[model samples]
Target: MILVGAVVVLLCWLLGFWLLWHIPAPGEFRRRAGRAPAALAVPESIPLSVSVVIPARNEERNLPCLLQSLAEQTRKPDEVIVVDDHSEDATAAVAARLGARVVRAPDLPSGWMGKPWACWVGANAATGSLLVFLDADTTLSPEGLENLVAEYRVQGGMLSVQPYHVTLRAYEQVAAGLNITLMMGMNVFTPLGDRLAPSGAFGPCVVCSRADYFATGGHKAVRSAILEDSFLGRVFA
Candidate 1:
């Protein structure tokens, strides 16, 4: 029994690593081609009106950080909408206070999770041509929104960014295993990743044209999905 258990654990580790090795890390190809990683190549003027939609549920404290980040963006969003998902806290008040247009998410319908439902509500209320769906807890760098918009203009597809956790303490290393596992699921790191169909989108930050979003049915189509990111990826695919 002990030998069998050892074999099972070994197989699981091997399988995990195999999956991990197949995904290409960002800028890997650039390095291989003897080129440096590309800088944020945003143009001087972006024609499309951009909307930053945040989905929040009891995130009053975290909202300020993300909202502040948005305020400091090099290219500011034309509009910011916060979908307050039935929070017990003052999420809506805080978002409105920060100049975000707050939309109170309706009572969750059957088979819908709070996050996706909130996202759907915000998307519908958004008036911009370009839509950026962000989680309440995500705080972007000064140029993050600009860089993302630039990528969307160039790539012309659903774009998702996985959150990069910045850890200064050794204790945060405890998340290393989970983080690596999550990255494996993204399937974009392997040397030949571009040749293969992408497996899924990350949940925290996603961008796309409003037309494509509605055409693919957006979060409304994945109302019941727990892994809304992966489902949204397929819908866009």
Candidate 2:
């Protein structure tokens, strides 16, 4: 009994430490790629037309903050599409109130899960050169779009970033930290930096060129996947 308890404690400690260690890499990438700033010189003469797509399901509590943040972007998205994924609450109403074009999600197709299906629905309705898949819980800085556009322009491929999560619970923080660390330990950015085929990055902040999105078959290819974002990343690679 003593040995089993000791082993369990040790495993928990190691896991906690590992997660905390990786928390900074996403922040580092955000800073290095220019998305962390509040102000940037976004060219008005050549503004990139971006479609920001948000997948929402009973997200009334989180939608307001995200919508306000989007409204404040330094380089505004040309259009915003919010897919209401069978929400029982005011997800559709709130989104429409915030000036986003709200699309009602149809029946969950046979293979696709909730979020990715919503993303696909929104993507089909989008009309922009750039497609940004943003989560309902994500809050972006004013210069967020500028940095994402810059990253896409420089790489000439897809761009994804790890967003800073606001966690009220200790376990949530630990999860965020650990997830970040795993990505860093895997050296996710180095290959992306050198233009090697982009691998699975986070889905929360995925941005891809519209042409590339279509070329890669968009979310249709990964409709049945539980890890649709990662699957899309592999396909992009």
Candidate 3:
């Protein structure tokens, strides 16, 4: 019985691998060709004004790292807006010290989730052509912003990135496998990712044109959703 179970598991793994391999690769699946800010040859004619929005609640510890990283971006955003979502900690102070424009998130209204409401507030305050929504815990590489802009110009739609897990604790390392499985289960790497169904979006980082974002009603459309990021992706699709 043990041997039979082992064989079944191995076969299942193989089948899963085969399915993943056979799926059509989306445009966003391309390798990181531009590794530095200078490497991204954005056309001078195309005016790309990016506004980065971060929604934080009691994220004082994590907010600093993200803000510092953003400061180091090769292709710097025109502005960074950090929405303080009623944080009990020094999240607002940290963001302000880092030179980010801090905005207070209004009291959560009925039928609105915290994160989405904060994001919506930030989006409304943003004045850039492109909006880059990033979580407080996310740290970007110096070239990350440049690469994102390059990719967006090529893909011409919403772009969501599933960050590479950098884990220190053993439990976190173990959880990484589950995270990958969840992403794969949603068909994130397949062509279906471009559609509404059987698709996924990573909430940690998302970039899209301001026009497209508002066209889909932004987070306001998914105000009550528990999985606002995933639902927002579907709305964009």
Predicted candidate 3 versus true structure: per-residue lDDT over 109-172, tens digit per residue: 9999999999999999999999999998899999999988887776557888878789888778
Tell me, by TM-score, which candidate is best. Answer: 3
Q: Quick one: ranking by lDDT, best first?
A: 1, 3, 2
TM-score of 2: 0.77
lDDT string for model 1 (128-200, tens) is: 9899999888999999988887666546678888778777799998887777776777656555556567777
Residue 152 of model 3: what lDDT?
79
Candidate 1 runs further than 4 Å off: 1-18, 21-46, 168-172
Ranking by TM-score: 3, 1, 2
TM-score for model 1? 0.82
Q: How high a TM-score does candidate 3 get?
A: 0.86
Off by over 4 Å in 2: 1-47, 184-197
Q: Better model by TM-score, 2 or 3?
A: 3
**What TM-score against the true fold does each predicted structure earn?**
0.82, 0.77, 0.86
Task: Give the worst 10-residue stretch by lDDT in candidate 3.
Answer: 32-41
What is the C-alpha local distance difference test score of each model? 0.84, 0.79, 0.83
CA displacement after TM-score superposition, residue 88 of candidate 3 (Å): 0.4
